[model samples]
Target: MAVITTKGVEKVYNPDKIPVKALKGVDLEIEAGEFTAIVGPSGSGKTTLLNIIGGLDRPTAGYVEVGGEDISQMSDNALIDFRKEHIGFVFQAYNLIPVLTARENVEFVMLLQNRSKAERHARADELLKAVGLEDKVHKRPAELSGGQQQRVAVARALAPKPTFILADEPTANLDSESTANLLDIMARLNQEEGVTFVFSTHDQRVIDRARRVVTLVDGKVDEDLRR
Candidate 1:
Protein backbone atom coordinates (compact mmCIF):
# COMPACT_ATOMS: atom_id res chain seq x y z
CA MET A 1 0.00 0.00 0.00
CA ALA A 2 1.08 3.57 -0.58
CA VAL A 3 2.47 5.13 2.60
CA ILE A 4 1.64 8.69 1.46
CA THR A 5 -0.88 9.78 -1.17
CA THR A 6 -2.18 13.12 -2.37
CA LYS A 7 -5.16 13.69 -4.63
CA GLY A 8 -5.52 17.00 -6.45
CA VAL A 9 -4.29 18.79 -3.36
CA GLU A 10 -4.58 22.55 -3.48
CA LYS A 11 -3.42 25.09 -0.95
CA VAL A 12 -4.50 28.69 -1.25
CA TYR A 13 -3.57 31.36 1.23
CA ASN A 14 -6.21 33.96 0.32
CA PRO A 15 -9.56 32.86 -1.04
CA ASP A 16 -11.40 36.19 -1.23
CA LYS A 17 -8.39 38.34 -2.10
CA ILE A 18 -5.49 37.43 -4.34
CA PRO A 19 -5.08 33.75 -3.66
CA VAL A 20 -1.53 32.56 -3.41
CA LYS A 21 -1.84 29.00 -4.52
CA ALA A 22 1.09 27.10 -3.11
CA LEU A 23 0.19 23.60 -4.18
CA LYS A 24 -1.97 23.23 -7.27
CA GLY A 25 -3.68 19.97 -7.96
CA VAL A 26 -0.80 17.91 -6.71
CA ASP A 27 -1.32 14.16 -6.87
CA LEU A 28 1.45 11.84 -5.79
CA GLU A 29 2.30 8.72 -3.85
CA ILE A 30 5.24 7.59 -1.80
CA GLU A 31 5.87 3.94 -1.07
CA ALA A 32 7.19 2.76 2.26
CA GLY A 33 10.98 2.87 2.75
CA GLU A 34 11.40 5.04 -0.33
CA PHE A 35 13.96 7.86 -0.27
CA THR A 36 12.17 10.52 -2.25
CA ALA A 37 13.27 14.11 -2.75
CA ILE A 38 11.12 16.94 -3.97
CA VAL A 39 13.50 19.20 -5.86
CA GLY A 40 12.66 22.71 -6.95
CA PRO A 41 13.83 26.29 -6.97
CA SER A 42 12.84 28.78 -4.31
CA GLY A 43 9.16 29.86 -4.44
CA SER A 44 8.21 26.44 -5.73
CA GLY A 45 5.64 24.44 -3.77
CA LYS A 46 7.97 21.75 -2.49
CA THR A 47 7.92 22.84 1.14
CA THR A 48 4.20 23.50 1.07
CA LEU A 49 3.57 20.02 -0.24
CA LEU A 50 5.85 18.56 2.42
CA ASN A 51 4.09 20.53 5.15
CA ILE A 52 0.70 19.26 4.00
CA ILE A 53 1.92 15.66 3.86
CA GLY A 54 3.39 15.91 7.35
CA GLY A 55 0.17 17.39 8.79
CA LEU A 56 1.86 20.71 9.52
CA ASP A 57 -0.70 22.46 7.36
CA ARG A 58 -4.07 21.80 5.80
CA PRO A 59 -4.91 22.02 2.15
CA THR A 60 -7.49 24.46 0.90
CA ALA A 61 -8.93 21.71 -1.30
CA GLY A 62 -8.40 18.01 -1.93
CA TYR A 63 -7.06 15.38 0.43
CA VAL A 64 -3.95 13.69 1.84
CA GLU A 65 -3.79 10.10 3.00
CA VAL A 66 -0.90 8.80 5.04
CA GLY A 67 -0.37 5.20 6.03
CA GLY A 68 -3.83 4.31 4.71
CA GLU A 69 -5.60 7.00 6.76
CA ASP A 70 -7.20 10.15 5.35
CA ILE A 71 -5.84 13.03 7.41
CA SER A 72 -8.23 15.52 5.82
CA GLN A 73 -11.07 13.71 7.56
CA MET A 74 -9.45 13.78 11.00
CA SER A 75 -10.16 16.35 13.67
CA ASP A 76 -7.39 18.72 14.74
CA ASN A 77 -6.79 16.80 17.97
CA ALA A 78 -6.73 13.50 16.11
CA LEU A 79 -4.26 14.89 13.60
CA ILE A 80 -2.04 15.97 16.47
CA ASP A 81 -2.14 12.46 17.88
CA PHE A 82 -1.51 11.00 14.44
CA ARG A 83 1.53 13.21 14.03
CA LYS A 84 2.93 12.23 17.40
CA GLU A 85 2.59 8.56 16.53
CA HIS A 86 3.47 8.50 12.82
CA ILE A 87 5.49 11.48 11.68
CA GLY A 88 9.06 12.61 12.32
CA PHE A 89 10.64 15.86 11.20
CA VAL A 90 14.10 17.27 10.61
CA PHE A 91 14.64 20.86 9.61
CA GLN A 92 17.62 22.81 8.32
CA ALA A 93 17.76 24.70 11.61
CA TYR A 94 18.35 21.56 13.68
CA ASN A 95 15.70 22.94 16.06
CA LEU A 96 17.27 21.33 19.11
CA ILE A 97 16.78 22.82 22.53
CA PRO A 98 19.89 24.73 23.54
CA VAL A 99 19.73 23.81 27.23
CA LEU A 100 19.16 20.11 26.78
CA THR A 101 21.95 17.63 26.19
CA ALA A 102 21.91 15.69 22.91
CA ARG A 103 20.55 12.58 24.56
CA GLU A 104 18.05 14.58 26.60
CA ASN A 105 16.67 16.25 23.49
CA VAL A 106 16.10 12.85 21.94
CA GLU A 107 14.49 11.50 25.08
CA PHE A 108 12.12 14.45 25.28
CA VAL A 109 9.94 13.15 22.44
CA MET A 110 9.51 9.76 24.07
CA LEU A 111 8.74 11.50 27.35
CA LEU A 112 5.93 13.37 25.62
CA GLN A 113 4.58 10.02 24.44
CA ASN A 114 4.45 8.92 28.11
CA ARG A 115 7.04 6.25 27.54
CA SER A 116 8.71 4.83 30.62
CA LYS A 117 11.81 6.70 31.74
CA ALA A 118 14.01 3.64 31.27
CA GLU A 119 12.57 2.94 27.82
CA ARG A 120 13.00 6.55 26.75
CA HIS A 121 16.58 6.69 27.95
CA ALA A 122 17.53 3.39 26.34
CA ARG A 123 15.89 4.24 23.00
CA ALA A 124 17.37 7.73 22.98
CA ASP A 125 20.82 6.35 23.73
CA GLU A 126 20.54 3.78 20.98
CA LEU A 127 19.38 6.38 18.47
CA LEU A 128 22.19 8.74 19.41
CA LYS A 129 24.65 5.94 18.88
CA ALA A 130 22.98 5.10 15.59
CA VAL A 131 23.41 8.68 14.44
CA GLY A 132 27.14 8.41 15.36
CA LEU A 133 26.87 10.77 18.30
CA GLU A 134 27.36 8.39 21.17
CA ASP A 135 30.25 10.44 22.55
CA LYS A 136 28.34 13.72 22.33
CA VAL A 137 25.31 12.39 24.17
CA HIS A 138 26.01 14.58 27.16
CA LYS A 139 26.82 17.71 25.17
CA ARG A 140 24.28 20.46 24.75
CA PRO A 141 23.46 21.94 21.35
CA ALA A 142 25.79 24.89 21.93
CA GLU A 143 28.63 22.51 22.68
CA LEU A 144 28.16 20.58 19.45
CA SER A 145 29.02 21.62 15.91
CA GLY A 146 26.37 22.33 13.29
CA GLY A 147 26.63 18.81 11.89
CA GLN A 148 26.61 17.26 15.35
CA GLN A 149 23.50 19.25 16.23
CA GLN A 150 21.80 17.98 13.07
CA ARG A 151 22.73 14.43 14.05
CA VAL A 152 21.18 15.02 17.44
CA ALA A 153 18.08 16.33 15.71
CA VAL A 154 17.98 13.20 13.57
CA ALA A 155 18.18 11.02 16.65
CA ARG A 156 15.43 13.04 18.27
CA ALA A 157 13.28 12.70 15.16
CA LEU A 158 13.75 8.93 15.23
CA ALA A 159 13.30 8.44 18.96
CA PRO A 160 9.61 7.65 18.64
CA LYS A 161 10.36 5.01 15.99
CA PRO A 162 8.24 6.97 13.59
CA THR A 163 7.02 5.35 10.38
CA PHE A 164 8.25 8.16 8.18
CA ILE A 165 10.55 11.17 8.30
CA LEU A 166 9.89 14.50 6.61
CA ALA A 167 12.95 16.70 6.26
CA ASP A 168 12.98 20.17 4.75
CA GLU A 169 16.23 21.48 3.31
CA PRO A 170 18.05 19.38 5.90
CA THR A 171 21.42 19.89 4.21
CA ALA A 172 20.97 23.59 3.53
CA ASN A 173 23.01 24.58 6.59
CA LEU A 174 25.71 21.95 6.29
CA ASP A 175 29.04 22.03 4.52
CA SER A 176 29.82 19.50 1.79
CA GLU A 177 31.38 16.95 4.10
CA SER A 178 28.71 17.36 6.73
CA THR A 179 26.01 17.03 4.10
CA ALA A 180 27.58 13.80 2.93
CA ASN A 181 27.70 12.42 6.45
CA LEU A 182 24.17 13.42 7.34
CA LEU A 183 22.70 12.07 4.12
CA ASP A 184 24.67 8.86 4.56
CA ILE A 185 23.21 8.37 8.01
CA MET A 186 19.64 8.99 6.83
CA ALA A 187 20.07 6.84 3.72
CA ARG A 188 21.45 3.99 5.80
CA LEU A 189 18.54 4.28 8.19
CA ASN A 190 16.10 4.13 5.25
CA GLN A 191 17.75 1.00 4.01
CA GLU A 192 18.26 -0.72 7.34
CA GLU A 193 15.25 0.30 9.37
CA GLY A 194 12.80 0.74 6.46
CA VAL A 195 12.06 4.30 7.55
CA THR A 196 10.49 6.30 4.75
CA PHE A 197 12.38 9.54 3.99
CA VAL A 198 10.91 12.40 2.03
CA PHE A 199 12.86 15.61 1.74
CA SER A 200 12.37 18.99 0.11
CA THR A 201 15.72 20.03 -1.25
CA HIS A 202 17.36 22.18 -3.90
CA ASP A 203 20.83 20.93 -3.19
CA GLN A 204 22.45 18.87 -5.91
CA ARG A 205 24.05 16.55 -3.37
CA VAL A 206 20.65 15.67 -1.98
CA ILE A 207 19.27 15.17 -5.48
CA ASP A 208 22.11 12.78 -6.25
CA ARG A 209 21.34 10.70 -3.19
CA ALA A 210 17.62 10.45 -3.77
CA ARG A 211 16.36 7.23 -5.31
CA ARG A 212 13.48 9.16 -6.85
CA VAL A 213 13.24 12.88 -7.52
CA VAL A 214 10.00 14.79 -7.92
CA THR A 215 10.38 18.17 -9.52
CA LEU A 216 8.00 20.96 -8.65
CA VAL A 217 7.55 24.10 -10.70
CA ASP A 218 5.25 26.94 -9.80
CA GLY A 219 3.25 24.90 -7.31
CA LYS A 220 2.83 21.93 -9.61
CA VAL A 221 4.60 18.67 -10.17
CA ASP A 222 6.62 18.97 -13.40
CA GLU A 223 8.52 15.76 -13.35
CA ASP A 224 8.91 12.55 -11.40
CA LEU A 225 12.13 10.68 -12.11
CA ARG A 226 13.48 7.42 -10.78
CA ARG A 227 17.20 6.91 -10.66
Candidate 2:
Protein backbone atom coordinates (compact mmCIF):
# COMPACT_ATOMS: atom_id res chain seq x y z
CA MET A 1 0.00 0.00 0.00
CA ALA A 2 1.20 3.48 -0.78
CA VAL A 3 1.38 5.44 2.43
CA ILE A 4 2.32 8.71 0.73
CA THR A 5 1.79 10.08 -2.76
CA THR A 6 2.78 13.33 -4.43
CA LYS A 7 1.75 14.25 -7.93
CA GLY A 8 3.35 17.09 -9.85
CA VAL A 9 4.34 18.65 -6.56
CA GLU A 10 5.93 22.07 -6.77
CA LYS A 11 7.11 24.54 -4.16
CA VAL A 12 8.22 28.07 -4.89
CA TYR A 13 9.37 30.81 -2.58
CA ASN A 14 8.70 34.51 -3.32
CA PRO A 15 6.94 33.65 -6.58
CA ASP A 16 6.00 37.25 -7.34
CA LYS A 17 9.28 38.89 -6.48
CA ILE A 18 12.64 37.13 -6.56
CA PRO A 19 11.50 33.59 -7.16
CA VAL A 20 13.13 30.47 -5.79
CA LYS A 21 11.75 27.22 -7.08
CA ALA A 22 12.45 24.67 -4.40
CA LEU A 23 10.61 21.77 -6.00
CA LYS A 24 9.72 21.55 -9.67
CA GLY A 25 6.91 19.19 -10.52
CA VAL A 26 8.19 16.26 -8.51
CA ASP A 27 6.18 13.07 -8.18
CA LEU A 28 6.75 10.34 -5.62
CA GLU A 29 5.05 7.37 -4.06
CA ILE A 30 6.26 5.90 -0.79
CA GLU A 31 4.84 2.53 0.08
CA ALA A 32 4.04 1.14 3.49
CA GLY A 33 6.72 -0.70 5.47
CA GLU A 34 9.56 0.79 3.44
CA PHE A 35 12.75 2.29 4.84
CA THR A 36 13.37 5.01 2.29
CA ALA A 37 15.87 7.83 2.19
CA ILE A 38 15.62 10.98 0.14
CA VAL A 39 19.20 12.09 -0.39
CA GLY A 40 20.93 14.84 -2.32
CA PRO A 41 23.40 17.68 -2.04
CA SER A 42 22.43 20.96 -0.40
CA GLY A 43 19.64 22.85 -2.21
CA SER A 44 18.37 19.68 -3.84
CA GLY A 45 14.80 20.11 -2.55
CA LYS A 46 15.02 17.10 -0.29
CA THR A 47 13.92 19.01 2.80
CA THR A 48 11.33 20.94 0.82
CA LEU A 49 9.72 17.72 -0.37
CA LEU A 50 9.90 16.29 3.12
CA ASN A 51 8.20 19.32 4.63
CA ILE A 52 5.43 19.07 2.06
CA ILE A 53 4.90 15.37 2.62
CA GLY A 54 4.91 15.85 6.38
CA GLY A 55 2.25 18.60 6.11
CA LEU A 56 4.51 21.15 7.77
CA ASP A 57 4.40 23.21 4.57
CA ARG A 58 2.01 23.46 1.67
CA PRO A 59 3.04 23.14 -1.92
CA THR A 60 2.73 26.00 -4.33
CA ALA A 61 1.09 23.64 -6.83
CA GLY A 62 0.04 20.00 -7.27
CA TYR A 63 -1.22 17.71 -4.56
CA VAL A 64 -0.02 15.52 -1.71
CA GLU A 65 -1.85 12.56 -0.27
CA VAL A 66 -1.01 10.57 2.82
CA GLY A 67 -2.84 7.45 3.87
CA GLY A 68 -5.33 8.03 1.02
CA GLU A 69 -6.33 11.55 2.14
CA ASP A 70 -5.49 14.59 0.04
CA ILE A 71 -3.66 16.76 2.53
CA SER A 72 -2.69 19.34 -0.08
CA GLN A 73 -6.13 20.91 0.06
CA MET A 74 -6.52 20.80 3.81
CA SER A 75 -6.83 24.03 5.76
CA ASP A 76 -3.98 24.94 8.08
CA ASN A 77 -5.96 23.89 11.14
CA ALA A 78 -6.97 20.64 9.51
CA LEU A 79 -3.40 19.99 8.52
CA ILE A 80 -2.28 20.42 12.10
CA ASP A 81 -4.83 17.91 13.32
CA PHE A 82 -4.03 15.53 10.46
CA ARG A 83 -0.35 15.69 11.21
CA LYS A 84 -0.93 15.16 14.88
CA GLU A 85 -2.81 11.99 14.13
CA HIS A 86 -0.73 10.59 11.27
CA ILE A 87 2.81 11.91 11.07
CA GLY A 88 5.69 11.41 13.47
CA PHE A 89 8.62 13.76 13.03
CA VAL A 90 12.26 13.46 14.09
CA PHE A 91 14.71 16.19 13.34
CA GLN A 92 18.47 16.56 13.57
CA ALA A 93 18.03 18.45 16.80
CA TYR A 94 16.56 16.39 19.59
CA ASN A 95 13.30 18.29 20.10
CA LEU A 96 12.39 16.77 23.43
CA ILE A 97 11.18 19.10 26.18
CA PRO A 98 14.05 19.75 28.56
CA VAL A 99 11.74 20.04 31.54
CA LEU A 100 10.21 16.61 31.01
CA THR A 101 11.63 13.20 31.69
CA ALA A 102 12.05 10.72 28.84
CA ARG A 103 8.79 8.98 29.64
CA GLU A 104 6.89 12.25 30.05
CA ASN A 105 8.31 13.60 26.84
CA VAL A 106 7.14 10.48 25.07
CA GLU A 107 3.70 10.87 26.63
CA PHE A 108 3.37 14.54 25.72
CA VAL A 109 1.67 14.01 22.36
CA MET A 110 -0.76 11.43 23.75
CA LEU A 111 -1.59 13.98 26.42
CA LEU A 112 -2.51 16.43 23.68
CA GLN A 113 -4.73 13.74 22.21
CA ASN A 114 -6.45 13.44 25.64
CA ARG A 115 -5.38 9.86 26.19
CA SER A 116 -5.91 8.58 29.69
CA LYS A 117 -2.96 9.07 32.04
CA ALA A 118 -2.59 5.33 32.51
CA GLU A 119 -2.62 4.75 28.75
CA ARG A 120 -0.05 7.48 28.19
CA HIS A 121 2.22 6.07 30.88
CA ALA A 122 1.93 2.58 29.46
CA ARG A 123 2.69 3.64 25.89
CA ALA A 124 5.61 5.84 26.94
CA ASP A 125 7.21 3.06 28.91
CA GLU A 126 6.77 0.63 26.05
CA LEU A 127 8.25 2.99 23.46
CA LEU A 128 11.16 4.10 25.63
CA LYS A 129 12.00 0.46 26.24
CA ALA A 130 11.64 -0.31 22.55
CA VAL A 131 14.18 2.37 21.75
CA GLY A 132 16.59 1.04 24.37
CA LEU A 133 15.96 3.87 26.83
CA GLU A 134 14.27 1.79 29.52
CA ASP A 135 16.85 2.67 32.14
CA LYS A 136 16.74 6.38 31.28
CA VAL A 137 12.96 6.78 31.40
CA HIS A 138 13.10 9.04 34.46
CA LYS A 139 15.94 11.26 33.16
CA ARG A 140 15.28 14.64 31.64
CA PRO A 141 16.68 15.56 28.24
CA ALA A 142 19.43 17.66 29.80
CA GLU A 143 20.59 14.77 31.96
CA LEU A 144 20.79 12.27 29.10
CA SER A 145 23.56 11.73 26.57
CA GLY A 146 23.02 12.94 23.02
CA GLY A 147 22.19 9.43 21.81
CA GLN A 148 19.86 8.86 24.73
CA GLN A 149 18.09 12.13 24.00
CA GLN A 150 17.60 11.14 20.37
CA ARG A 151 16.24 7.84 21.56
CA VAL A 152 13.69 9.74 23.60
CA ALA A 153 12.79 11.76 20.51
CA VAL A 154 12.20 8.52 18.61
CA ALA A 155 10.11 7.17 21.45
CA ARG A 156 8.02 10.31 21.42
CA ALA A 157 7.54 10.06 17.70
CA LEU A 158 6.30 6.48 18.03
CA ALA A 159 4.02 7.32 20.94
CA PRO A 160 1.27 8.34 18.55
CA LYS A 161 1.50 5.19 16.44
CA PRO A 162 1.79 7.38 13.37
CA THR A 163 1.30 5.85 9.96
CA PHE A 164 4.91 6.46 9.12
CA ILE A 165 7.90 8.22 10.65
CA LEU A 166 9.35 11.24 8.87
CA ALA A 167 12.87 12.05 9.98
CA ASP A 168 15.22 14.75 8.70
CA GLU A 169 18.93 14.39 9.29
CA PRO A 170 18.18 12.20 12.27
CA THR A 171 21.75 10.92 12.68
CA ALA A 172 23.53 14.18 11.91
CA ASN A 173 24.37 14.99 15.54
CA LEU A 174 25.21 11.52 16.76
CA ASP A 175 28.62 9.92 17.13
CA SER A 176 29.42 6.68 15.29
CA GLU A 177 28.30 4.35 18.03
CA SER A 178 25.15 6.26 18.77
CA THR A 179 24.22 6.46 15.12
CA ALA A 180 24.74 2.75 14.72
CA ASN A 181 22.68 1.97 17.78
CA LEU A 182 19.86 4.25 16.67
CA LEU A 183 19.87 2.72 13.22
CA ASP A 184 19.75 -0.73 14.74
CA ILE A 185 16.69 0.11 16.79
CA MET A 186 14.89 1.69 13.85
CA ALA A 187 15.77 -1.18 11.54
CA ARG A 188 14.53 -3.67 14.07
CA LEU A 189 11.28 -1.82 14.37
CA ASN A 190 10.91 -1.69 10.60
CA GLN A 191 11.57 -5.38 10.28
CA GLU A 192 9.74 -6.76 13.27
CA GLU A 193 6.82 -4.37 13.57
CA GLY A 194 6.59 -3.31 9.90
CA VAL A 195 6.85 0.37 10.80
CA THR A 196 7.48 2.56 7.79
CA PHE A 197 10.11 5.30 7.76
CA VAL A 198 10.99 8.08 5.38
CA PHE A 199 14.09 10.18 5.97
CA SER A 200 15.91 13.07 4.32
CA THR A 201 19.57 12.74 5.19
CA HIS A 202 23.06 13.64 3.99
CA ASP A 203 24.72 11.04 6.16
CA GLN A 204 26.24 8.04 4.39
CA ARG A 205 25.56 5.94 7.45
CA VAL A 206 21.86 6.62 7.07
CA ILE A 207 21.86 6.12 3.29
CA ASP A 208 23.64 2.80 3.61
CA ARG A 209 21.02 1.54 6.00
CA ALA A 210 18.08 2.52 3.82
CA ARG A 211 16.41 -0.18 1.78
CA ARG A 212 15.45 2.36 -0.88
CA VAL A 213 17.30 5.50 -1.91
CA VAL A 214 15.66 8.33 -3.83
CA THR A 215 18.09 10.96 -5.00
CA LEU A 216 16.89 14.47 -5.71
CA VAL A 217 18.66 17.01 -7.83
CA ASP A 218 17.55 20.38 -9.18
CA GLY A 219 14.21 19.88 -7.47
CA LYS A 220 13.46 16.55 -9.18
CA VAL A 221 13.99 12.91 -8.47
CA ASP A 222 17.21 12.07 -10.28
CA GLU A 223 17.44 8.49 -9.13
CA ASP A 224 15.40 5.88 -7.34
CA LEU A 225 17.17 2.71 -6.26
CA ARG A 226 15.95 -0.20 -4.23
CA ARG A 227 18.26 -2.78 -2.74
- Candidate with best lDDT: 2
lDDT of 1: 0.92
Model 2 steric clash pairs: none
Q: Per-residue lDDT for 37 in model 1? A: 97
Instruction: Itemize residue pairs with steric clashes in candidate 1.
Output: none
Q: Give the poorly placed runs of model 2, Cα more than 4 Å off.
A: none
* Clash number by candidate, in order: 0, 0
Angstrom error at residue 3, model 1: 0.4
Candidate 1 lDDT over 1-227, as tens digits, reads 68999999999988899989888899999999999999998988998999999998999999999988899878899988888899999998999999999989999878889999999989998999998999988999999999999999888888898889999999999999999999999999999899999999999999999999999999999999988
CA shift of 200, model 1, Å: 0.2
